[model samples]
Target chain A: MGRKLLLEHINVPGINTLEVYRKTGGYRAVEKAIKTMSTDEVVEEVKKSGLRGRGGAGFPTGMKWSFLAKPEGVARYLVCNADESEPGTFKDRYLMTNIPHALIEGMIVSSYALGANTSYIYVRGEMMPQIRILEKAIAEAKAAGFLGKNILGSGYDLELYVQPGGGAYICGEETALLESLEGKRGNPRIKPPFPAIAGLYGCPTVVNNVESIAAVVPIINDGGEEYAKIGIGRSTGTKLISASGNINKPGVYEIELGVSVEDFIYSEEYCGGIANGKRLKAVVAGGSSVPILPANLILNLVNGDKRLMSYESLSEGGFTTGTMLGSGGFVVLDEDQCIVRNTWNFSRFYHHESCGQCSPCREGTGWMEKVLHRLENGHGKMSDMDLLVDVSKKIEGNTICPLGDAAAWPVASAIRHFRDEFEWHVRNPTLAVKENFGLAHYADPLPELVS
Target chain B: MLKVEETQSVEFSTELVNKFAEIVSRYPEGKEKSALLPILHEVQAVNGWLSSVAMDKVAAYLNIAPIEVYEVASFYSMYFLRPQGKFVLEVCRTGPCCLVGAEKIIDYIGEKLGVKEGEVTADGLFSYRGVECLAACGFAPVLQIGPEYTFYENLTTNSVDQLISDLKDKASKS
Candidate 1:
């Protein structure tokens, strides 16, 4: 069994209640941090633990905390990004639904660490159930004296509120979330003034992912060094992978960071392999935004090293033969699935979700979607593939936020890794719409490495 | 924009007004504009959708301009600007769900309801549309109904039929 820090007691009945969660050692971090350690000490402990943001970017958590600008008499805020809208990514929703108090406890400890008296968890509006759950849990915690003025007799004042997003995926971005929290349209802000420097009502703020904040409880419980000792290299501690799409066990699994891709898929511990005895065709290791990898490339690196689930290991070859461990939304495609259809599906999602703050992302995503739609519907020309590549390149980095790059990567990567299937569509036209090209060479074994 | 065709005015109930007041209290004093989204949700939940009058009243309640509310209400996929069926079936249509048959489920719902996507039924009881990921891909081919956003997952055509009938039964009882 792997070490389950955040979800150790997830399956216990009544775990969502404060009483059962308390029995399972919840809120111990709040007591320890508020009553014993100073704010800087809590931050230092997280820094030593080497925790990275689990919300796709993989940026170091402690470093993000340190970036908060603290001017005297200026209030600091910590906002939890609970907007888990990326397709194939559902870990935050699962964690929030099953273990609501875990997040509340982390909020208390993290708010103390940042010396902020106010915090909010910006959840997506579609998760009305989860927002209600967190609200109930927060009220229970407040009644227990875990929140509000002078918590646990420690003279630390904190108020945590659950903010609902208006169903915009762009709000998952830190600045866009802050904008939404301020009752504005979800538009990405230009950087030189990142959210850490000035955010939410123009205060010095720190926006952390829900998982990153929840991981703080365990880090503060056992010392940071003990927490850091679990996983390999910089990818310390366990990560929750939301396995979906053609997998037998399509659910959230927390694994120690170094598990190999093959074992994670085939082993009964994780995904339990592709569903219904089907052969794996391809995998999107991260969420939809990351590059999709062919079966051979996903199973083994270009150098023939077995790919592991750690941030460094999964991204070893850097886009050519490797993909990100983004948000840990591991989606698997069986041989029966069509890459062209899936690509078109993802393009449509991006096009619909483009916030339209930047012209390139707004226009480019629509163009890609239309072109891919035609390609899938048997109306594409041979030059359509290159046109897609060209348009995607134009949108890659020309926007106010990474949503542009996100809109670009899947289209580019699909063409890079699966051009032949696209060409087959252009040539076969009507036949392509009637049937898929099937697995083709995607599942073939990688050529042996020459010494 | 506000559907000018539907010019029906709405009056906020005292209880809902109090609820709006509570939502506004969650933000800092000068930042009552922050209460806009939550207030709009509450308004939409009470009435089936936001009319020009309802949004104007929400703006007055929050002391912000009606355009502010209009821009936000329009920007979000939620917050129906026009009236909808009492039960809106939002099925997931993103990549992962499609991999596991979301599209087929959407088509089945449309066929069974005798209404296309975004169109209300003749009885005005149900409307269905393909929404983006609901963050429940593991339980792919999922659909949810609004007002509470209750989820129904791992759907087949039979499950969808059962759900529509159950919802019809529910509406009849209510």
Candidate 2:
């Protein structure tokens, strides 16, 4: 098995409880950080770990902490973006559900490093169960003297609270999360004064994903250099891959960052290959927002090098033939699935979740959804293909948030990779609705690798 | 969406008022506005949905304008604008789930309930809707019932049938 930092004790009975978690060396990082290291020392350790934000952006976590504006007398905040709403991404929910205290411990250590006494975990409201689990965990930690005022008698103080989002996907965005936390509508804010500079009640704030925060525990416990030694260069440390869709074992898997895409999908150690012995057709290696790649492209690079599940490797060829390791939401599709219907389904999700903050995303997502809906239902015109791409182009990078680009990428990428499937839907409209345009060239053998 | 016929004024119980106070305490002193989402959830738990009267009352309690509450309530998918059945069955309908038969599960729930999406059953026992990704695609074909938001995952049609019956039995008993 790959090294597990966050989920090492995940299967331990009663790991969700403070006693079991503590017994298994859960809060050692908190104790080590608070009792021994300076705040800067903790930050320096994270910086040295080379941990990137696991929420999808892949921005360096240590650098994000370094960006926090530390103004005198101004309360800094660390808001854990527990709103794991991206389609196909459920690793945060899994991590938070199974090992609640790991996140709480990470929260305390991270809050200290950012010099924030007050922090809030902005969980999506649908995860009321997780919110309750975290709340119970936080209460237990506070009772154990790991949280609240003067923790561990180290003269450091911190207060952590769990805030529920109002079930909007856009709240997963950092600034939008801040807005939702304030109990306002979930709308993306214009950048340049990113959340690090001014956030959460206008205080200097840092918003990190749930997995990113939880990863801090091991970084502090093992020392950053030791933690960084596990994964491939730059994509240091293990990542939690939420493998879903047509995979045989569809669940969360903690993988060392450099694992080949083929091993992750087909090996018994990971996804255990496609379900029902079906051939793999396509894979959304990341969440729905990232480009969707056919089987041939996903398993190998354009140059026929084996694709690895790291930030640099997955995104090797850019949007053309490459996808992202976004949120590690690896969704696999077998031979039977229809790309057209799935594209339409994703477009509908984006349109429904646009937040209506920007017209390009707001209007553009609706157009994509409507157009894709027609295509999926076998009512598509030939020009509808170009129209879809045209609309996607208009929306990409034209909105205040990435939601526009997110909505556009899947539609554009599906057409880019599977235009014939879409054309088949158009030509054989009746047949398309009755049956899927099966695997086709997507499962073809890759060209011989160049030495 | 709050029709004149459905606007019923709500009274905050002392117990609930105390709960609101606790939620408000989690934020900074002046930023009691941060408590709005949690407070609305608490209020919605009491009543099945947020009426204009209830929302305005929430606005009054938070010291924010009533429009703030309305805007937030309408913006979010969770808060019901109309009265729903005792159990709101939210099934995941996004791409990953659909690949693994989430759409079938949603259709099953709808057909079994005899109520289309957003429509409450006559018995006032259940309502079902297709929600966007619940972030549980790994356990696709999943559904959850709210108040506690208890999840039911990897649902087959038979399992869904068992759930509806179980929920029906539960409602009759309680």
Candidate 3:
């Protein structure tokens, strides 16, 4: 039943239309939430339901809604963080492309909860085609009177706009995104005023990710308590995971939050097992930003008791063995993959995407990237291994945003778990060279084409 | 915040306006701001780069705040805030592309055009900048001419020279 909660109405004929969505119990949440429940009651329902932010951080959704500066004379905004730029994550794209109305409907209901008048969907600029699709859906929603002044005889006035970010990865951070939305650079600002106090035109604003808002529709429609009953413990409700890398069937999977990591990988029910029948070597449980775990650590039960995927349980082992459930981008690594090489790939992405605002991140990312690049290219000294660790340590926790930490985590974790791989590469560079890096598509015609 | 200059006038030509109107008709009513990206895109397409005047006119047409229009235009890497040359070459200088001498291509172009990375040529014929993920990973090193994302696969010094020559030839004719 939880296999497709977010993507439930996806396959229905013409489900893209407001009429069809309404027929299938769409906007029922708004009807129930607006006409019946008070805004405080609605927020309480969400809080009691234990619904967490589905956009990686797993922050309590209702609690976040509670943070808004009450309906003051000043206007508040609901910003949907649709800038899904995490490596190995593409579920938000699917939501935007196939079932945009779900997101739009959710936006209306959620905006009502926080007493917001204007909402913006800050989508990544790279997703040009998906943005076009969402634009059409939003237009349809407005035409049906689901948006704008007076909605379904309710006097709630709301306006939705789609803003395309300049494709900076740092914009995924809420403060940075708000800055970018304000027609400036996408560099993140330190939080104190928080978006809830002063955001977007210096008014209280609520920024929730794409999946986080979409989940709110169902929570309100089916009673948040009932939604909470599905998943175990504090890891309530379902999670939309974007699984990729070495897996046989890599794509988006919506599952009850506490499903075991092993079940997700080995069970035919999820992911269809690893591709090429290769043995799993490691898994980056969350996005590349999280730590990477070796296969043995993931298979073993926590404290040798339970094998679980809940936020608390998964992170129990910390970066030493378990990875963060951040963003649910499960990128698995096959045995053929080299940990050093893969870690370098992640470091390289962060280095390129760094906003260059914070000194530590700006200087440290470059140093780490240069060290990793030299090591990966088979030109490494033993001291370079220590240097990589040293650079990552300096970069993490020293920046204005989580991006510096996100960039540093993979490098630090990879070295921690697979120092031998780096040592091997340093000891015998030629031996470490594989005939093929297993790139999907190689420029040389002799290599297999991806498309 | 930008006031449209009297000389530039911040108004669209008939051709760009027609394209903009056509795009607007594609969306539902009251969501005209959705066309903001495409409108700015069309302005950039016709006017080379988005001048402050052009952005203001676009803001007026979309009925969004001038700041909103400017935000979209500036946020995207593709949109040029300042003026660019007739041929703007954006070299992909991140990861896979950088692994195999995207820097060399930039160097070659700089030497050929006699301008630094962010500088437009004195003749206003060429400008260069570094970018990320042109989505041509297999190509290793790639560059785009204006908005035309051209991938130069398996690049060498000679191959880049050929591409420059080809671009120059095409620009001269067009």
Candidate 4:
């Protein structure tokens, strides 16, 4: 097994409770940072660790923190993005539901580093149980002198609260999250002021993903040098990959970065290969928003190099022949699955969650969904394929938020990689409605249950 | 719509008022309006859903305009504008779940409950709607009900039938 930083103690009984978590060496990071280390020291160590944001964007966490503007007497804030609504990405929910204290401990250290006295975790409202657990954990931390005034005999003080969103996927974007936190609609703001400069009611704020914040505890505990030695060159840490879709052992598994895609899929330790001995057709390696890769492209690159699950390796072809590791959602599709139907499902999601801020996104998403619906159900013409490409291109970079690109990329990628399937639907309109594009070279025939 | 709307004089229970105060205290001194989301949640829990009257009370409690509350409430998928069944079944219909059999499960819940999407059953016991990803893709075909969002994962037609029966039994006793 690789070094499991975040999930090392995940299966420990009562780990959710404060007393049990404390017994398991929790909150040591807070003591370490608050007692011996300076704010710059903590930030410097994280920078050395090369820890990128685990929340899709993969921005460097330390760089993001250093950008926090410290205007005289202006209070800065650290907001945790717990709105884990991205399809196929559930690692945050698992981390919070099972080990609530990890996030709390990390939040305290992260807050101290940024010189913020107040922080809020904006969790998706649907996750009420996890929110309750976090609230309990926060109360326990406050009672134990880790939070609230003068923590651990240090002169620093921080107050953290759990804020619930009204359940909009667009709120996962940092600015929209800030807007939602301020009790407004979840509309993403235009950037240049970037939350690090002016956020959360005109004060500087830093919003980090739930996994990224929790990963800081381990970074502080082991020291950044040691943490940097765990994963490959750039991907210098363990990542929690949420394995789902047609897999035997489908759940969150912590793997060292740069593990070969072949090993991650076929090895018994990770996904335990495809389910029911079926052949793999395609895999949305990251979350739904990333480009979907066919099974062949996933195992080997266009350059004939074996593919590794690293940022550099995954995006080698740059949205043309390769996909990014966007949140490590790892959704696998078997041969029997229909790409058109799956693309339609994602289009419907974008349409339902467009936020209606920009006309390109708001209107383009609905049109794409309608077109994809026609394409999926066999009521499409040849021009509909070109129409899909055109619409997705229009929505790609024309919006204030990445939600537009999110809606567009999957449709574009689906057509780019699987054009024959889309054509098959139009050619055999009646047959397409009655049947799926079955295992035609995409699926490898199996002799046994184990892939 | 409870008395929060008609009379403009009805007050929330003492316990709920205290709870709201405690939550509002988490924000900055004058920014208690940040507690609007949680307060709206409490309003929905106390009342079946957020009526105009309930929203007006929430607006008054937060000292913000009712339009602010309405804009926010309408933006989120969680808030219900009208009365729903005692139990709202929100099934995931996004990509990962659909790859596994979420669409079938959504249909199964609809047929068994005799309710179309967003419609409450005649007995006022069940309401079904399809939702975006619930972030539980590993266990596809997941549904959750509010107040706690209790998740029912790896669902099938048979399981949906059993869940409907279980909720019906609970509703009948209440």
Q: Which of 1 and 3 is ahead in TM-score?
A: 1
| Interface root-mean-square deviation, each candidate | 0.5, 0.6, 6.3, 0.7
Note the residue pairs that clash in candidate 2.
Answer: none
TM-score of each: 0.98, 0.98, 0.78, 0.97
lDDT of each: 0.92, 0.92, 0.75, 0.90
Candidate 2 per-residue lDDT over residues A1-451, each given as its tens digit: 8888888888899999999998999899999999899999999999999999999999999999999999999999999999999988999999999999989999999999999999999999999999999999999999999999999999889999999988999999999999999889999899978888889888899999999999999999999999889899899999999999999999999999999999999999999999998999999988999999999999999887899999999999899888999999999999999999999999999999998978899999999999888888889999999999999999999999999989999999999999999999999889887799998888776652211
Better of 2 and 3 by TM-score: 2
Q: What is the TM-score of chain B in candidate 2?
A: 0.95
Docking class of 3: incorrect
Candidate 2: regions farther than 4 A off:
A447-451, B1-5
Better-scoring candidate (DockQ), 1 or 2: 2
lDDT of 3 by residue, B43-159 (tens): 776778887788888888777788887766765677888878877877766433443456677788789878888887776677888776443333346676654333455567787
What would you estimate as the lDDT of candidate 3? Answer: 0.75
- Residue-level lDDT tens digits of model 4 in B60-162: 8888889999998998989998888888899999988988899888888777877689887776777889999999999888999987889999998888889
For model 3, name the residue pairs that clash: A56-A327, A166-B75, A248-A275
In order, the B-chain TM-scores come to 0.96, 0.95, 0.87, 0.92
Tell me the lDDT of candidate 2. 0.92
User: For residues B1-174, could you state the per-residue lDDT of candidate 2 as single tens digits?
Assistant: 112357556899999999999999999889999999999999999987898999999999998899999999999999998888888999999999999898888887888888788888888778889999999999988888888899999999999989888988998899
True contacts kept of 1: 0.88
Considering summed lDDT, which 10 consecutive residues are worst modelled in model 2 chain B?
B1-10
Better of 1 and 4 by lDDT: 1
Residues A129-187, model 1: lDDT tens digits:
99999999999999999999989998889999999889999999999999999999999
